[model samples]
Target: MSACNAIASPVLDPKGPIAAAQTQLLLDAVAIMMIVIVPVFIMAALFTWRYRGTNRNARYAPNLAYYWPVEILIWGVPAGIIFWLGLHLWSATHRLDPYKPIDPEVPPLRVEAVAQDWKWLFIYPEQDIAVVNELVFPAGRPLALRITSDTVMNSFMIPGLGGQIYAMAGMQTRLHLLADEPGEFWGRNVQYSGRGFADQQFRAIATTTEGEFGAWVEKVKASTQMLDATTYEQLAKPSVKVPVTYYSGVQPGLFDSIIAKWHGDGNHLHAQVTGTEQAR
Candidate 1:
């Protein structure tokens, strides 16, 4: 997509609540920085013309040194801007924390993500189904992702939904996102792993229509393919630009086993954190 176009930037054209807030923050940052940038550029032009050697009428103050007003304008203004920006950043960091649930009252849809060499595996535990390079969830609900890498480290991001989290072998990362309505948002691995990294992408579908999510799940369940240990072994092999695949069944505890395979202790820390969140 042409990011330079007004509507081409996924970040700027947010379809989710978190992305919308991030967009606002970006615009605000630009406006605040322009407070100094615009005037500085304009003053630079005026100063260059006024102090030119050809301009004899211009006042030449060779010995005139410091002006407290100008010093305050440059130093104090930036200081204030930095202080304000810092506060905003601090608040946002906590407010948009990926671990925190969007609405504590609403139960989040859990999706386990496994990052491989050149593709993504999304497993819906509650639904007992899995898909390759496609993530589907009900819209207007919070999505809680448990992500890890089976190969090299990778970064997961959905620009239109905001936030970026890394997936590392033997470690699980958390990210919570919510879509405001039905739409297909782009999801990809931003980290560079190999030649196939360019094709490490997926489609995130948010279903707004009633029964849509259920119908999609049913469709996946109707697929003949099954995800067993042997099946997963072959599926994990490195490949590029893999077409979407659906599995009617998933081996129980498959997600945990993948973590244990890499990290001897398993995702004990993440499990503990998840337990604590549930209690609250």
Candidate 2:
């Protein structure tokens, strides 16, 4: 999408009220900071001109110690600004903590996510399906995602949404998001993992209806190879800028296995190979 169009989309159709509120709050904070920053910059320039030694009219007070009131203006003002900022930030962060549930009336759809070397794997336990390198969901439905990483730490982020959540090995994190409209959005592995760090990104396709979403699942399942235990072992290997792929059937609870292995389980010997496969 054009940059102008992308900018307009988020405003015109925010994922939900919470996201819209966040965007507004961000813009407001920027404006407030600018009020102080702009004046400080202007004064800096003015001081350079007004205090020029070449101008004999300029008074130079060599014995000048800071006046108490002037010191108060310098410290108190910034402290107050910081206090205000801290209050707003603290409240907003807790209110929008990714793990917190939304209103009871609007239940969220749950999806489990895993970040591995060079790719993302999303599992819809409710739908009994999975996808790699692509995310699809019904637009307007609240989505609550439980995320983790198979090996290294990664971050789940989509700019048009809100704050990102970190996915670390053997640990689960949560993120709640929704696309207000039907279209494609991009999500990335914001943190560097290995060779593919620069291009470890994927598309999120939001559908208008549940039927459309089901059709998508069927299509993906029909078009891909069956991902069994062996294939998954190959997939988990590290690599760079790997292209996207869809798997019709992945080994049962593969993500769980990865998490277990990372946590020091001995069930899978494959997981024991550490740095050797870092390049895959």
Candidate 3:
């Protein structure tokens, strides 16, 4: 369902160096673009006032000559802007590449994510754990996510953290994010995936310590539902505004099996179970 929480806002917080750099880049670009845009408007206003019909002394030269320096000033400025933009673009791309590892002293926490019909499935492979509707990570630590999709393409995004990465069947995309503070952030599917697109959302809880994360994982593992193949089939079906759920134990490599089937590749043949749940 739509996860709109008013408690914490990630965009307003600059927890790490990358986030701060990104914010500065945005501000600088806006300032640079406005240089030409503002002056053009002022010149247009001045020309309109000075060239009014009543002023007979105003030169009405219909044949205007083109000045090379003025042409260069107009064209070269934009070209320089484009070059500046390209440099920043390349720097950010290399820095944010999902596969690229973070600093050795502060490596990103690994997270495997799967985007399904109308929900998200997050698995912490190191912990041998899974959560159906919620995801958690430690603050001030880099997060490396291995993301993929089930039926259609979806995007994994947390604006407070960083850019959105696509989750498509048969392929894996990487995303790196970090939060400096302990708070709950919002994550959602930015792209339409199907019937319940609008309701596809989840909670991204950023905790302070490993102990707290371990405790939360233990609580999730203590849930009553068994997340076997059958249970997953029901849970994966299209459902709108479904409440958050946790499964005690999940079948190993269930996400891989789904990806295999979706790609039509003969990786592993898992039985497909159909359900009558209404598509949202």
Candidate 4:
């Protein structure tokens, strides 16, 4: 395969600030580890050559048992590296949390994502718009995503966006992200679902300006298609490699309804959706 075809992962080509930060962290960790790794490898080669049986004049101490300095060099160095690694992990975990909001200066765009049988359904509740296998938003604006699954377990991931979160039936998960510049990024289900899992992919377009994003929404709204209960039921069915689709209108509270279905009782679902559920 050609080099272009072989390089398909977006994690290596980050386009967002969060992804860039993550990439830096990975590089830093590897570089720090090599400090000890490289020296150990070099010492191994040197010791083997210096202590070779062919070297008749080599000095040897058969009674040598322990050396405090050597012991400290072996154990202390690795312990210190592990300590630094722990500190970095703790800081990164909180700083890059998926639930935390991005830049406060830019108003966040709310998006509800549903992982269906073999496709992605993105719903814009504020705009009353829904699309299948396509996600579009304005660049430089924070994106707050509420994700869930209608059928089975799945994961929602955009490699250029940094983190991947699970979307489970009956439970809602949150992810916050933003695109530093305007461009199209790849999104897919990293977790295996079923037969159509390989074909499950989507394009996430980040428009350059708010006006362009507004125009795109207007164009979608002009479509005649509607996503009511009946249409949604059909969309929830098993399918493979579905094309991008647009819906001018979406049913109200549709996302909540999908989460409620797995709760069994209506009250529990309501409480869970409304964030009022308490420990039993």
The candidate that wins on TM-score is 1
Model 2 CA deviation exceeding 4 Å by range: 1-19, 250-252, 266-280
- Local lDDT at 218 for model 3: 90
Work out the TM-score per prediction: 0.90, 0.83, 0.87, 0.88
User: Model 2, 1-280: lDDT tens per residue?
Assistant: 2354345445424565566767877887887788689989999999999998787798878999878998987888888878888999899889887787765578777778889888888877666566778788888888888899987889998666666789999888888887777877667888878877866777777899989988988887785586555676777788655566777665556566667776675546354333224533
Clashes of each: 0, 2, 3, 0
Candidate 1 lDDT tens digits, 88-132 = 988988998888888989998999999997999999999999999
Which has the higher lDDT value, candidate number 1 or candidate number 2?
Answer: 1
What tens-digit string does per-residue lDDT give for candidate 3 at 1-280?
A: 3334623445545555556667777777787888789989999999998998888888877887987998999999889888888898788778766566666677567778888888898877767677876889887778888899876899988767776779998788887777778888777899987778887888889988988988888998888876666676677677777677777665666666667776675434244312212211
The 10-residue segment with the lowest total lDDT in model 3? 271-280
Per-candidate local distance difference test: 0.86, 0.75, 0.75, 0.86
The count of backbone overlaps in candidate 2 is: 2
List of clashing residue pairs for candidate 2: 238-280, 239-280
Error of 2 at 54 (Å): 5.1
